[model samples]
Target: MRRNWAARLRHVTIDGLRAVVLENERLRVTVVPGKGGDVVEFLHKPTDTDFVWLSPQGLRDPRDHLQGAADDVAQFIDHYEGGWQEIFPSGGAPSEYRGARLAQHGEVSGLPWEYDVVVDSEQEVAVRLRVRTRRLPYRLEKTFRLRSGTAALEIEGRATNDADLPLHAMWGQHIVYGAPFLRPGARIRLPEGVQVIPHETAINPPARRVRAGGPWRWPLVPADGGGQSDLSVVQEPGSPSDIVYLTGFDEGWYEILTDVGMRVEWDATLLPYLWMWQELGASTGYPWWGRAYTVGLEPFSSMPTDGLAAAVANGTALVLEPHETKVLRLRAEVLA
Candidate 1:
């Protein structure tokens, strides 16, 4: 019931200096600029409402907003079914596969950025992609400011780490929405004393005490495969759990509930963990068969897989000595 990705895009192009091509209503949004400014792409066309995607293609996943080659980085665990993306490499840089040592999500999604085309707002269209990570000396600034309004996206960032590894990293803004734009009234709003963690349910493999409490309620307890941990979850618009959650948002500002409030707001104060991933078809453990509709608000400085060794064993995973500079700020708010 949304139906209007900026009046079907009509056509807008700079094509690629850094990239900027919005063509709504069948949706084809590409705003790329290294890790931080990465919305990469999202193509879905059901017959061109005016034009969403039919003139620019290279979508395997990651929204088909395809932003490859700065070095043409590719390695989603060795082809995550072709096109998952790669390029965030830096100092340690060395991963072609196998458990993955460094470059998991550090640097800037496979570095090689510095692109520009500006207008910022009021519909002149925008694109600003800057990157710096010469082996982690640290300096990242990404701005993919696009405007025509709601289908919605906004992100302005900064990160300065003057050399020193104590900078454990994990940040997420991987938004993937498809299947008639995830129809079914679409709902997923966070912050209200958040707490939701659902990854174990193959008859309970090992999820460990259900997120323990803070922002709890997703598959909170009770699942054979009926679905219920949080109440606003909807599937069938795409039938995959289209809304997604993994919350605890406050200073990180998060809210999205499609179907006329037309929303999307994510502001990361150094990312405090937010992941609302959804899956369908056998549900999910992702060994793969496939089902539609997607969601992943993933913003993290730590919180999964030893979370940087549990933030370095309870000291809060951030330590920079020998000539250091640490200043981080992230903001994104677009509402209608």
Candidate 2:
């Protein structure tokens, strides 16, 4: 029994899978190594709020999950439980890149990862998680660290190309917010001069608010109902499901302000785009069935979620030379 208090680390199991818990005075984070190293729980101790959303389907181990249907998207959606997922290689939809079949969000996010505790102390605790893509010739390693007396979680990652040839891929941090911290009247804050690009087509039809087609300024867009809709303010349930991309970042930081707030910062050079996905219960379509009420603030290296091939066609995909490595840094802090 290792009992200290300022910062601590523990290993446990969830649904017969390996899990790691890292905590301090202000936050508790639960990571399931077996499930794509997903950060399922990000709890703010002071507010008793969990910032990450939990989907209706909940977490299901892919190994034991029997696929009723065969489809490129079902592999990911069926097991998705609305936590933070690190999207790599391919994002959005399935695509074939250089003859290799890439599934939705790539192969790494659905596979198990190996973990090792690097630092264990009262002042700080850190663990490193690593995974290699089954199809792509790449390896990803990330370290999660928590310090005593701080409400911030720091993540440092590296993606390396293990093959002898150059590779093109898309990388993203899919972080979503919901429930206690994500209610009506909540506000989203971004740096000045940031612009929002609405999805090409309207989603959730009749309920959709922001008119399609906009390189609009932050927070406000021409509404479909003849007035301007405030994108900054979270609307009531049943609001349209919207997808927008934020660009022209003076810095790589965004804040969600409510009774309990959260600030997320990342390396802007590595991830130049931020994807805002709002599935606020208006999606009565396939998958959601109007059961979702969440917003995803994702920092991505590519745009529009059409998959890697589209990103390559648009010239937004990141290219890694043979044996090259890319480093990533990100942080999430609590604000009340």
Global lDDT of each candidate: 0.41, 0.85
The candidate scoring highest on TM-score is 2
Tens digit per residue, CA lDDT, model 1, 1-336: 222434322222333324445543334556544223445444434432111111112323332334342222232322222111222322112332123344444446544467665553335355556677654455655554444533444446555566544454333444434343344445655555555544442112233233221333444222344554443544442243433234455656555445432234555445554545554333444333444334445555444423233334434344545344444444333332
lDDT of 2 by residue, 216-268 (tens): 32332323543444677777887766777876676899888898899999998
C-alpha TM-score for every candidate: 0.30, 0.92
Would you give me the overall lDDT of model 1? 0.41
- Which candidate has the top score in lDDT? 2
- Where is model 1 poorest over a 10-residue stretch in terms of lDDT? 48-57
TM-score of 2: 0.92
Q: List where candidate 1 sits over 4 angstroms from the true fold.
A: 1-19, 22-27, 32-41, 46-113, 116-129, 132-165, 176-179, 185-227, 230-274, 277-294, 297-301, 304-336
Mind sharing the TM-score for model 1? 0.30
In model 2, where is the ten-residue run with the lowest total lDDT? 202-211
